[model samples]
Target chain A: MNAILSDYFLPCLWASLASAGFGLIFNIHGRGLTICAFGAGLGWLVYLLALDAWGQDIFAAFLAAIVCGFYSEIMARLRRCPVTGYLLVALLPLVPGAGVYYAMQYCVQGENERFLTTLLHTFGMAAALSVGAMLVTSVLRALLPKFHRAIH
Target chain B: MNDDKLLALGAELGRRLMSSGAEIYRVEESVIRLLRAYGAEPQVFAVPSCLFISLSAPDEPAVMRMCRIPAHGTDIELLEQCNCLCRELCRNPIPVEEAFEQVTHLEDRCRKHNPAVVLFGYWMTTAFFALFFGGTLPDCLSAGLCGLAVGLCALFGTRITGSNIFFRTTVHAALVSAFAFLLLRAGVAQNLEAVTIGSLMVLVPGVALTNAMREIMAGDIFSGLNRTAEVILVATAIALGTALPLILGQYI
Candidate 1:
């Protein structure tokens, strides 16, 4: 239990704080900032859980991104605002910043093989993240009107 | 209805939406909806850099307007306000003049964070991201310092960084990597990777990558390709920028 808390919960907290800070830079205010930060925490939590289950970082990112997309879409519908800000801010934690760094390090050290591997892994991570989030967005866009009609 | 003013208003609002970092479809859809609400059938096209709108009504001359949007940063508050105003206008038809004034002055009403607060935001982001990436407390502090430098450059170094987005991102990434190296050498930071990655988070093109994918999926293949190219350029610039510092550090 303690290990889970330290490993998963702590990182989620950090991700939330980081996202909130990024929200400020993006000029998000008040409740919108909170939503973005919360979404970030939620997405990171899901990512961690999925990582533990599958042991595939890209697949975990894809799962986490789908959750974030749903959260952003629901929040946008409630607030009648664009989903771009929330989605963009929340996904910051999962973006492959470290991959870019490692790739650069390897290239600088003249390790072509590792550089190519890291580069491909980074691209795969990005593609998975995009595909996951966009899948939710596209499906929701098609079905949301029916859902709204049903609710009414 | 004065067709000239109505068309101008539509074009202006669409330009504002584009400049505020709205997606391509949103800008086009919003303008078309707004014009239709005012009894005009409008056609709108928007890319990342420019917007085109052409409308023809029965009695008035066909007017087409094109506006080139300036380089912009994300301002979510402005975007929200613009979207809300557009929706309100569509719900209740308003005088084009009054609506135009409101759309132009939208930025005046929304509160803006002061520079100090934004700098603090930069510090907090890098610090927390360092911790999230498994850095120690000291490493987090150093990363925060590097973040501060990056924020300063982003906010006030436009003259030095210039207008080229690629050059600006490269400069920011290089600054972060160099700062991380110096801090590591000075014994202020233990985890070079943690500090550097945390600082580089601010420069990553995650937004563009996501936006590109969204545009393609939404059927704006042109805009999607444009943003994808931007993502690739920025990624290459980052790799080059960070590599410079590492290569130089080897000699020192």
Candidate 2:
């Protein structure tokens, strides 16, 4: 239980609060703020789980982004608003801020090889996130109506 | 059909959507759909900086309107209102005049948070991100202070940073890095990296990156590439800004 709390619950709580703060920066209000917070927590949780299973941060980010994308789409459809806010805010925790920082540090220190590696890794993480979210968005946009009609 | 009024309404809607940081596809589709509802077949082309709409009504010559969108931040509240208004207008075609008035007043109707609340948000984000990145308590506090400085600069120091996006981001990143250095030297923060990275989160171009990918996926290759270049420029600005203070700190 302690391990679960420390490794999972605590991190998710922090991610949720951080995402809530960013949501405020983006001028999200009301229930949408709460939704972004929870979605962020959920995305982080998925990332952690996928990391443990795959041992690849890029793959983990991709999976987590897919989840965030679906959550944002469903919420947007229900709320009758654009999905941009939710997806953008909720995905904040997974963005490669650390990678960008470390790359800058390495470059400043004149460690060319390390900086190059970190830069490439950062690009990979970013590309994975975008592709994951875009994949879900495109697939859902093309197929959700068909599924809805079938259900009806 | 009053071609001028219809053209005005479509152009206004597109401008509002673009200024609210809507994806290029969303802006184009919304304008096209709204004009279609009014029995006009319209063509829309949107880049990050400008939107162009052209159409010909029956018994009328082709008319076009081009609106240049200014630099904008993400305003989800305004985006939601504009989207909702567009949907309503499309579903039940309102008078072109009334729709135009509503589009123009959308900004007034939005409920923006007070400056104080936004500052609090900045503080909260940095403090929590410091903790999230495994910083100690003192580091978190220092990061919060740095966040406040950044928030102040961003909100009220527009004159200093100017309108250039790259220069503005560089100024913000430099503020965060310099504050981190000061706090570390004063022994208020334990880790320079943790505090700086925490506060630096605000300047990252995650929104532009995400929107770029979405636009690319939606087949607006040109707009996507435009935003992607922005992301690279801002990232480069951040690196330069961060390195400046740290390199100077070494000599001091």
Best lDDT among the predictions, by candidate number: 2
lDDT of each: 0.91, 0.91
DockQ of 1: 0.71
Q: What's the TM-score of each model vs. the native? A: 0.97, 0.97
Cα error, candidate 2, residue A59 (Å): 0.5
TM-score of predicted chain B versus true chain B for each candidate: 0.98, 0.98
TM-score of chain A of 1: 0.94
Candidate 2 lDDT, B25-52, residue by residue in tens: 8898899989999999999999999999
Please give the distance, in angstroms, between residue B72's alpha carbon in candidate 2 and its true position after superposition: 0.6
Candidate 1, CAPRI quality class derived from DockQ: medium
DockQ of each: 0.71, 0.66
Clashing pairs in 2: none
TM-scores (chain A) of the candidates: 0.94, 0.94
